[model samples]
Target: MRSYLFVPGDRPERFGKALAAGADVVILDLEDAVAAPNKAQARDNVRRAVDDGAQVMLRINGAGSQDFIDDLALLHGLPLRGVMLPKAESVGPLGELAEVTDAPVIPLIESALGLWEVMTVARGPGVERLAFGSIDFQVDLGCDGSDEALLHARSRIVLASRVAGLQAPVDGVSVALDDEAVIAAESRRSRALGFAGKLCIHPRQVAVVNAAFSPTREELEWAARVVAACERSAGAAVSVDGAMVDLPVLLRAQNLLAMAG
Candidate 1:
């Protein structure tokens, strides 16, 4: 799941287009992007999108909002791959959501309150992944959305997710679309910081995001050799192509193999 793209739930025309746009997952957004008057339409659209059987995730409104209950009630029986709970501040709301639906919940932590309670949210039963909402988080922190400002929050999400044994936290969207080079650089930076995936705003950004996150040929080759050498050494530390492969290296090789699959 390298490229996770967003699609407005109310726009049926864009659903197939987004999937064909090379996103590993298409998030049908119902909050923030959609207007207050369009909430009902967004819910209806999300329900229809879920029925399409694609890897669709509904980004429901915040828990206390009227739209969330309505969206959940409508999406309960549908076969959505997951639900992205926005502005998650604690485990209580996620637990409530889990009680009603069994789909994997991908919580988006945006506020300071949410960041402080990240561990609690990660410990919840149904969360499969944690995503940082850089824009909202930056707003909450009253700081610019630069790497330095968001670094700690990004690392915090990664640590919290790992502690809960969930997939590595996904990096927030790169708002700049015109500067592909900047996007690539930021994507690489985020990957280096331990984010396993990125949220892309446009289709043109998908390939770059995927390429940045995917293990390179050289990386895979090293991982393969490490795997073979580890097998020979009974998973103990050993020399692989002149480099010493230890437990950390072995685990990385396993992750690479999983990515390859």
Candidate 2:
């Protein structure tokens, strides 16, 4: 899933529109996007949407909050793609959550402490992937939201996910709704850093993100040439476009083709 779009849980009227927004995954946000008094109504809306069989993920409240328990109760028997736990910093809560539902989990790393404990969180029970909550992480670290400022955090999450044998971590949302250029640039940066997907706050950001994460036509052509050269050489050392084709390069080419599929 290259683009995971978030729709405010309280705004059920927009759910269908969000589903049709071309995102690979749609997340119903019950945490940050929802206000305090509207949480209950949002939960009901999410339940109705899920019961109606929308293939979506759900972002519940923090594990330490009372809303988390209520959210779990609301999800007791429904089928969902997964649950995203915001401010996830421990494994015990996720383990308990697994006992309640069989759904996979995606832990959102949003704080300095969460960043420090990321490896453990990635290895937690039922963890399918990790996601960086870059906005909140910046606030926690008292840093600017520039890529240079958040580079270490993003790299750490990617490394932790790999070490835990989980999918590459998802990058946080880009807040500039009017700037598709900036969104594409940031998504390209995330992909270069080994992020498999990006989070989208608006439907307008989806196409840019999906395109950024996918291999371009030029890349596919290069990969195909590399693969063909490797096959002709029958695993022997060969040169492709002036560079030596070795095991690592061949493997990368193969992986690129697999991702293209």
* lDDT top scorer: 2
Off by more than 4 A, model 2? none
Error of 2 at 195 (Å): 0.4
Across 4-70, the per-residue lDDT of candidate 2 in tens digits comes to 9999999999999999999999999999999999999999999999889899999999977889989
Clashing pairs in 2: none
lDDT of 1 by residue, 143-204 (tens): 99988999999999999988889998889999888788988899999999989899888888
TM-score of each: 0.94, 0.98
Error of model 2, residue 78, in angstroms? 1.3
* Alpha-carbon shift of residue 220 in model 2 (angstroms): 0.4
lDDT of model number 1: 0.87
